[model samples]
Target: MTPSPATAAVRVRRAELSDLDDLVALEQATFDHDLVSRAQFRRHLDSDSARVLVASANHRRFLGTALVFFRKGSRVARLYSIASLPEARGKGVGTALIEAAEAAARQRRCQSLRLEVRIDNESAIRLYERLGYRRIGPVEKGFYEDGSDAFRYAKTLA
Candidate 1:
């Protein structure tokens, strides 16, 4: 039986090595031709400065994942990727993962959280804007594989 949203238990926590496969699968499902390989996922899992969070429902199925990197000198946190499984979209998994990342940034004394979203992803753009992120600039041809431009958004916590 499929788990219903009402009964689904969504947990957002720090991702471990064991979650790499699910993360990669979700990445592949979320983005076209921009999926991170297993090697890259392992590297991120081993990195100290990288914060990866995963959301799961019913303690079994992976719902979504978010990856963020911390910058030392500038104390800025950059959100590298935030992807949710097709079944988890619009179900608050992405928002929960993002919130967890922001909390981590706050704990690390990061001044702000910044991320780039493809200009054509209207739903994601709307979500970020609603979450208090302000677009500062555009990354010209930032997404090479698909030749899509990216819009940079930042949310200052301090």
Candidate 2:
């Protein structure tokens, strides 16, 4: 049994077609803009270079999801999106997803993982930093749907 963000054991695994609803639900519940559509989730689940990982407990309730895009002909994997239930914050859901993403990237022979977080998302920034991801590039202007800027971050895989 996997431990849930709240109390149960959490399990991280590759997403399946049945996971579309939960994936969309998490996407809608997490970000205010640039949401991942149901069609997109299906496409990602079928794509070879894209991965949608889900974290759940007892295969019942979902805890979080992470979307990773692997660049062809490149050693970089992009952590395009990652989000956990509000109650899952600071409960290792994000960390588990990140670790799974890193493993997925490494399995694909990726050398580094990269992502962009809204400049105003201090908690996310702190999480990335705490996980050893360093700021890589300049803050992107008008990055989000609400025109919020974003900070680029990256971490080299061992």
Q: What TM-score does prediction 2 earn?
A: 0.91
The lDDT of each candidate is 0.81, 0.88
Clash counts for the predictions, in order: 0, 6
| TM-scores, all models, native as reference | 0.88, 0.91
RMSD of each: 4.5, 3.1
Tens digits of per-residue lDDT for model 2, 1-158: 23335433666889999889999988988888999999999999999999999987655467899999997898999999999988878887887888889889999999999999999899999989988999987889998889999999999999
What pairs collide in candidate 2?
Answer: 2-9, 2-10, 3-8, 3-9, 3-10, 4-8
lDDT of 1 at 77: 95
Q: Which stretches of candidate 1 lie over 4 Å from their true place?
A: 1-9
